[model samples]
Target chain A: MSFFYVDLSVNQSKTWEKLFFDLKGTKRYNKYCQDADFYNVFKQIILSLLLGEEIVLLDADFSEDEIKRLTANSIYETDDILVNKQLESIESKEDLFQHLRQINKEWQITLYTSGTTGLPKRISHSFQSITRFVKKSENHSSNVWGFAYNPTHMAGIQVFFQALLNGNPIVRLFGLSKEQIFESISEFAVTNISATPTFYRLLLPKFNQYPTVKRLTSGGEKFDEKTTNALKQIFPNAKITNVYASTEAGTLLASSGNNFFIKPEFKGLIKVIENELVIHKSLMGNSDIFSDEWYHTGDIVEIISQNPLNFHFISRKNEMINVGGYKVNPHEVEEAIREIDGVSDVRVFAKSNSVLGNIICSEVVINNDSLNESLIRNQLQTKLQEFKIPRLIKLADKISTTRTGKIKRN
Target chain B: MKKEKLLEIINTIKKNRNEVLINSIDETSDLRNDLGMESLDLAELTVRIEAEYDIDIFEDGIVNTIGEILNKLENKR
Candidate 1:
């Protein structure tokens, strides 16, 4: 009676037996445009990979124009060599699991970037590269995952592979409200949760502790000390970790805290050049953007220790706003605002101004209505320089997020 | 009325920094010299005024005095 996935929104659950049953006769598409339910999307990815076929995943909420732009208006076109391959039926769930564990093929999975800074780029990964960080052990079999990322993105694919390979049940928690997310976590007794810092920030000002969660993973955005501390309070029993991954590359580094250390096996595969993290071409997916041997990650990291080779993310290189000749990192400003009492969430960005080429601006979500622009400005004045403090502050009911759950920069 | 509103905005910015508030302002008062406002402060003043009057006082070029801001607003009206 092992369950595959549980959908709290519909109050429906699917079993491992049903997954195998559906896979027996499921129609396989070489280049699938999956804008369907989470169960179906997961099922299609598994079926395609099992048959050694290529698959393209698109966000379910993407507009028709966006889909056209991503696919170059060729959604139904397939250039895959394995387009005509037949789907093989497995006799039992054990056989399916065995196939997954022993599977090695040239099957490619395509994913689009969240496009926070500019247009999303399409990157393709081989089966081996996508599952390079997936761990399989008897201990992992008992862990229940609270899936909280978009199924079409890189982080979600990593979670799916990890859970599927370990035979763990996943409780869907993406796109759920703060109250609903907690409700699902308690109801399912979810043990492991992986999501962005923005997703975790929405659950701030904690009310009740969920001791069932034993592990929490933060990725896709900067995991600040404030959010990490709040997560510790909510998931008191969980061991929190941060994973560094991207659309261009799958999971590469994992850290117990905000600081990351390159594993001994991956020492040569990763390096830092002028503050930007660089990855070897061997570790990245197939994209024209990686013509060089080292792919510039465009992420700026601050080195914390030289002996242990420890570093932590600072901010994206493109995220720095030039405000009147002063470089302002919005993350720094946002962190200062987050430390202030009564603030639920804050998004600091740049606004085109006639005076300063670009002026720092922020939209803040606060629990206390008495928190006003001047009060926040005064508090920030002590922590940040005059140019770093946002020139314009707007109170928002909630901070908007991209399709991949990262805070919307624009 | 616009002059009073501009004075209030200026005082709010001053109050946040614990600076002495100015009760009255004239058209000839220099923003940087007389009011002791820096470039960042002027930037904030630009946005606050844009929010209130729907006009960017520094859109065309740098405005060094309250008279320039009021003139920008008056032109918009």
Candidate 2:
């Protein structure tokens, strides 16, 4: 009853109060019941809160069958694959609450950077650190960003907390096709939208059939020229923007509402240490848990803008793929391939090459349901810088996505 | 576009277009569901709207809401 559970079957969009009623009527959910209301997950979560258990809420897109399968088979038990020495799980709701509350006492949040580059990193966020992003919705667009990413991820978790405190309307848009997102938008009269380049890029071609959007926002992955232009083409003239937040460092930098931004000064001095930009937050990692203010943001961005801090994305310090003398950012090649029409999504990476030191290889997601290779190749030729072009492109029916919405990059 | 004309345009894009006309959306009916426009449909609808309204929306400064879009359409007339 305390949870606001949405009824997906109903034609009407339920207000939080209506959802609260649905929750009241619903029985306590075990992890397995298919069609179990997501709000039930909240109830289980709240129940876990009272009982001191750390419950991992998977994205609702997973069917009951899938949840049963994954929970039964997931490799969380093995610490071997845990990135950044973060394999250990904390026990109890009390453990999380204490850690979070103490952090909240002195700080506002602890966000984990998406592991798109290499490994996920933990970034400390004071209430002040996220002021822009916290009020991010109210200040920019009115549309609620449905938990587009996974709650297990930092962005999703932050959005969850932000929506809870702000009373914003955000449904979990798991497994729903682009069609469903459009439905949610019009149904909610949604005015603001946030998504990754892949999410929007995949949905862009379909824009030819949808209603006009009010605001469009994207981040996470490479928000390159072709993707931005494609978004513009789809939205016509929606308020489009991006941010450059990382996990190890929270909100270290943000782009202006326009694609370009002047990198803001850190509370502490920031510098490009050994070509890798190291930013010093007054505090970094987990909580007021650690007090080291000077932290290196292992991201390497070419300093194109600074006063208002505008920096062009160069490459991740560790993810740079060198081809002979040519330094290639995986994102750069992905962006190039993305520029190619019919290329729905791309994951470009380095492979051992005899000619080039590390040759570029791409896994491309296309609407092979209807493919026109010539048109795409032509488009890629025009938009992409020669070296940035992928040497090989493999068409995929579905790109392997992490449990989170992020495409698996490794 | 007149209600009937709008209905016709929408119908061509959707499977059951007459149902949309029968539904009769004004400011309240959500185009995505009440009218049956999916995400792809919305993208297509905007293209139609842009062609019909002869306006540039979905940019940095363009109006981005349904109500605002409707108001813009009304004003254009």
Top model by lDDT, which number?
1
Q: How accurate locally, in lDDT, is each candidate?
A: 0.86, 0.52
Model 1 docking grade: medium
**Residue A147 displacement (Å), model 2:** 2.9
For each candidate in turn, the TM-score is 0.94, 0.59
Candidate 1 lDDT? 0.86
Candidate 1: segments with Cα more than 4 A from true spot: A28-30, A79-91, A102-104
Q: Candidate 1 residues A1-410, lDDT tens each?
A: 28899988878799988887787665435475566589989988887778766788998878888888888878757654433434454666577787776555778899888877667899999989999999988888798999998899999999999998888888999888788899999998999999988988888887799999999998877778877888888999999889999989999999898789989888778888899999999999998778999999999999887656789999999988998888998888999999999898999988788878888889999999899988998899889988898877899989987788877777
Query: What are the per-model DockQ values?
Result: 0.63, 0.01
Candidate 2 matches the true fold with a TM-score of 0.59
Highest TM-score against the true fold, candidate: 1
> A226-315, model 2: which lDDT tens digit per residue?
667776776664767676655544444445343345334452356655656665654344543245555656667666545544556666
CAPRI-style docking class of model 2 based on DockQ: incorrect
- For residue A21, model 1's alpha carbon misses the true position, in angstroms, by 2.1
Q: How high is each candidate's interface RMSD, in Å?
A: 1.6, 17.5
Give the poorly placed runs of model 2, Cα more than 4 Å off. Answer: A1-15, A18-132, A136-143, A208-212, A256-270, A287-293, A306-308, A324-326, A353-357, A367-389, B1-77
* Ten-residue region with minimum lDDT total, candidate 2 chain A: A80-89
